[model samples]
Every structure is written in C-alpha cells, then in structure tokens.
Target: MCKFLQHTGLHQCVPSPAGAAEGTPTTHQWMLRASNSVLMLLPAYHNERVFMLAYWILDLGSKKKKKEKKKKKKKKKKKKKKKKKKKKKKKKKKKKKKKKKKKKKKNNNNNNNNNNNNNNNKKEEEEEEEEETLLKIVPTVVCSGG
Candidate 1:
C-alpha cells in the first residue's frame, strides 16, 4: 500500500489511523491526504520562475566563456611581447657587430700608418751609413795619390 502511494508521487508523512474510518474529521490525516494530493497533482510554476533560472544559467555560462577568452587573449599578448623582444635583441646584436667592424677597420689603418713611419726611418738610416762610407773611401784615395 505504501509502495503504491509512493509510485504515484504521493508521500505518506505519518502513520494511518487505527480503523477504517470513513469521512471522519481527522486533522492529521486530512493534512497528510492534502499533502499527498498536492504531490500527485503538481502545479506548474509561473513563467517568470523559469525565465529567472534560465537567465542566471546563461549569464554564468557567458561569464565563464568570457573569462576563457580573456585568458587566451592574455596568452597571445605574451607571445607577441616575446617576439618583439627577440627582434629587438637581434637588432642590438647587428648594431654591435657593425660597431666592431668599424673599430677593426680603424685599428688596421693605424697599423698601416705605423708601418709606413718605420719604413721611412729605415730609409733615413741607410742613407746616413752610405754617406759615412763614401767620406772614408774618398780621403783614403786622396792620401794614396799624394
């Protein structure tokens, strides 16, 4: 009997009366029967109730989707920043290489100037030695002829 009532979506709150009394003014039994009848014949709620519930659910889903989109946007921004930094680094390295090449060229020019000065000094020394040898040979020949 209880299972049959439950199958019909009716809950038995309390125990039934002692005897099979019909149409008796039993307040607790009336309340129980009224509750059971209410459970069996469920009334549809207002449209506003369903609309409010659906609005909250949809609102929450959109908020979650927005948050995920923001995270993706942030990740994309980070990747862009990283790529920019890499390009900046490469530009700096190229500039440094150009500066080093310029410095090397300057040093080579200075070395060539120094080599030219040394060659000039060696030519002057050779000229002085030839002048000394000619002076000694001319005097010896003049003394021999006298």
Candidate 2:
C-alpha cells in the first residue's frame, strides 16, 4: 500500500487504524478521503483530474524511467607552424664637409683722420665769427660814452 502511494505521488500511507485489517472498507474510506482533499486543493480542471486518475491507474506497477548517461567526444589538437624571421640590413649615412669663409681686412686709420679734419675746420669758422662780433660791440660802447 505504501509502495502504491509512493508510485502515485500522493500522500504517504496512513497506518491502518489499530486492529483494522488491510483492504478493509474503513481503510479504503480513509484513502478516498485523503485523495478527495488533494483534488480539492488543486486548481479546478476536469481534464487534470481525469489525467491524474488515469496516471494513478495506468502507472501503478510500472518502474520509473532511468536517465541515460551522455558520452563525451574527444577533440583533436592542431599543430602550430613555426614562422621564419627575416634579417634587416643596416644603412650607412655619409658625412657632409663644410666650406671655410675668407674674411677681408679693413684700414680704420684713414676713416678716423677724415672725421678729425672735418671737426677741426668747423671749430675754426666758429672762432672767427666770435671775434668779429666782439669788435663791433667795442665801437658801439665807445660812441655811447662820448
């Protein structure tokens, strides 16, 4: 009875009432009561009730199906090819030669003498003008005194 209950996926078997024989009308009544409660607690679907009733009747003595183990396939590893490296050639740079510039010499004494002569001539002309102005002023003073 317990095995049947387990297979049906219903409530655990209720021990028979003390001194009550198995398969008795009282035990059947208890089972029916429990089943009725389970059905009422479930969603109201006529088809679901029919299916549950059919499953309970049909799969009573059938064994549970065992899950099959899946086999793993072996993967082949690929070989990596080695790449050859190329050698780079070094380039030589040519050095450029620089040309030297020639410098010319200048005679500075001639330029200095010319500048000094022009300055001396200007000074002499200014001294002569000053003497003429002094002579004219002396004559005017003598006339005023007389």
Runs off by more than 4 Å, candidate 1: 1-51, 105-146
Clashes of 1: 0
- Which 10 consecutive positions of candidate 2 have the poorest summed lDDT? 96-105
lDDT of 1 by residue, 35-118 (tens): 435333334333454335445555666799999999999999999999999999999999999999999999999999999999
Q: Which residue pairs clash in candidate 2?
A: none
Q: lDDT (0-100) at residue 26 of candidate 2?
A: 41
Measured by C-alpha RMSD in angstroms, how accurate is candidate 1? 16.5
- Poorest lDDT segment (10 consecutive residues) of candidate 1: 38-47
Question: Candidate 2 on 1-146: residue-level lDDT in tens?
Answer: 34444444443345556675653334344345465544453354445544475446334423322111111111111111111111111111111111111111123456567778988898999999999898888664444654
TM-score of 2: 0.23
RMSD values for the candidates in order, in angstroms, are 16.5, 27.5
